[model samples]
Target: MSTTTYPRRHLGQGDLAVSAIGLGCMGMSDFYGAAEDERSLAVLNHALDIGINFFDTADMYGVGSNERLLAPVLKARRDEVVIATKFGNVRAEDGTFVRVDGRPEYVRSACDASLLRLGLDHVDLYYQHRVDRTVPIEETVGAMAELVKAGKVRYLGLSEASPATIRRAAAVHPIAALQTEYSLWTRDVEAEILPTCRELGIGLVPYSPLGRGFLAGAMRSADVLDANDWRRQNPRFQGDNMVRNLALADAVKALATQHGATPAQLALAWLLNRGPDIVPIPGTRQIARLDENAAAATLGLDAAVLQQLDQLLAEHPVAGDRYPAAGMAMVNG
Candidate 1:
């Protein structure tokens, strides 16, 4: 939401609607670097005030610190926005490593834990953060459908799930959205996932739409990353891969200049151009940067310019995989 509503995008199936752009809350608590809770809370409030009704978070993000962080900000306006939280990535109480779990009993308990963390009896949308291959998708989604029937969750989602698994889960219950890594560099979704979602009327929620801050032109070098920064562990951002990828970023920056848009805006605009039903969620803990990202809706792109971008990006494909070895090991697709 902005001075204007940006626009409404169909999320899953019949009757569901959300802003053209959503807010990814993962970085507000952990992963990217140390988070500024005070500033992050302000950003969340600002998002709601601007009409950004779709707010995304996960159970493992901060091991529930993210939901707890949203407690103060969402307490008064809980009903105004679509609060989407995820489960499946289980953590030990010590807050160390997490593993995927889609056991039926675990699903119920995890949802309950998320509810307690958010201080809400029911979540607007609940997603399985990752597919647990050991547990059938039917079992996981069946447990999720029960939550809907029991009034604990309004809608369901799956993150990084394969198209086949998505269809299998949809057989249990209609999935409102599929959250996945989707950016210019991460184009694998276009070949299978996006088409399957379109055919089934499931909305595509693009996470890391800014290339995880790479498309923003803020990260110029691997050396710019703090020692603890997760990107440093990413192959695409390591060693020569780091310098090689900047050429692609430079192309995006050039296109942004010609279009009178920021590289971040160009990146988001590119995703929005992919389909009307797609919503790009870029995470930010700074209010000014949040506003800038939201403003991407105002910067539109026509067909010819979009094709030009496609060709340029195609010519200068990014180097490195989107995730590190351990992280890549969990993605369903």
Candidate 2:
């Protein structure tokens, strides 16, 4: 396991705090493949054992199974970790996703459902998983603000929201963080979103920070993925794109050999050097992978190394868009 230790960072620009590196729970339940309940639980417990004080989840993950999965441990040590979960993605009765719902009623109902499944009175951090264009951001954030008022949630956050949308949401209430897909290959945020968050004193919680395992070199071939694995749908993992991305991974692997760190560890450590305001949530169900990701906190990244990374990224820009066109349309971008 990771023996490296670093000072913990503030959760946002507020009193809440967590380890510089946090655990992202999505892979344990959904994206990677079929959810292995036992293995996922073991990883969660292991995170606590290793001082990963930040744990993230969402209501829509596993259609509630993720929260149910975390319920027992959360109840036992609620005060020890910072729990972050999200809502807004709505699913129908038959498991068909209907649409994003930031409506006041849905917000309240979602919170109640998450609370019940988690067996908790409050969520330390609550986020709108996606910005619902049909609903005004002010209206949606107003509802989230109510949860904080009711003591059902302590902090508010927005995910995949555009710069304008983030500002609109903040106008209604102070949003503690903006959760979005950000990594070396996917840098749309560097243009405007990051600047806006900094101006508002909002932390940027980057999900899929290792480019959804693409940069980690853990996945070099598409044949290894499930037929329905989410990565299969990602453009970077498809036919020609996959071939080109593998070339990039090869270069990263070479660097890893020179640096004496795994590609996964190097990718994560590069993210650590991005900025203190940015917290990456790299998810995995294996304790070994978790330890490597967490140990990124201590990996060194001097000017020359960062320049080399920038050059590599520029030379082999990822071929396709990060998400499928359908999901891409939903991002407030």
Candidate 3:
């Protein structure tokens, strides 16, 4: 169990409570660049020490390497932490995403494999990483509900699903949370998806709340990214888009200075103020950066500052789609 209890947020309708600011463990294994296991483990341990109990991972994160990386850490503190991992978004042995698979048999096998990797009997929350359009939402969620019924999972969630699909899934089972890319610049959910979640009483877990570290004003251009960095392929970090997006980052930096906080803190504070039903999981590989993200839970953004930040985002409207063309095809399903 954790020595320090962090502030909590409830997902969906049940009594499931997790820390308001969770740690997204994606970067610890893959995507951004190569990861040092020693450094990642330290960051994970520090997250628990500082009261971040909710840890997010996915099978495809490192083609299962990410879950393996988290296994030892979660095994030691099984009772204290809530481990959330996703299936679907299938990937090949080479780590290239192939297609989404929501077949009932695949679901069963995936959960079992994930449990093996995490060294846990049950996962706290399980999400369908992406909606498999070929399979009906009801069928997919039905298979997930079985995991809950059998004690393999405690709660169910969907990532990047459309409002209609969410409604359908909720009809089959109580959807706990919707994990989607939501940040200062990514507000597409606000129009319909967010309000729909509110009506259904489902909580929102905003992934990349710092705009993939862009809103922190630390990244100036795509040139700054290592050749292997995934952000290099992201549209918003490319050529002209990179130039325009940095302006948005500059605005956040300006607000951060006025509010006596780092740009990352200001960005997360804005998300926390959006509603109590929202939880933002900001990932970091560095121990110092982890503390900075956890501190955002305590940074309060008042109405005026929020308004200024809102206007800044509205005026700039960001430069490109949150993902590349192929990745974009998988979202809002």
Candidate number of the best TM-score: 3
Clashes by residue pair, model 2: none
Model 2 clashes, total count:
0
lDDT (tens digit, per residue) of candidate 1 on 112-139: 9999999898988899999998999999
Give the clashing residue pairs of candidate 1, or none: 1-50, 1-51, 1-52
- lDDT tens digits, residues 15-64, model 2? 87777878888777766788788988888888887788788999888788
What TM-score do all the candidates reach, one by one?
0.97, 0.96, 0.99
Give candidate 2's TM-score: 0.96
TM-score of 3: 0.99
Local error of candidate 2 at 91, Å?
1.3
Candidate with better lDDT, 1 vs 2: 1
- Model 1 / residue 319 / CA error / Å: 0.7
Candidate 2 or 1, higher TM-score: 1
Question: Candidate 2 or 3, higher TM-score?
Answer: 3
> lDDT of all predictions, in order shown?
0.87, 0.85, 0.92
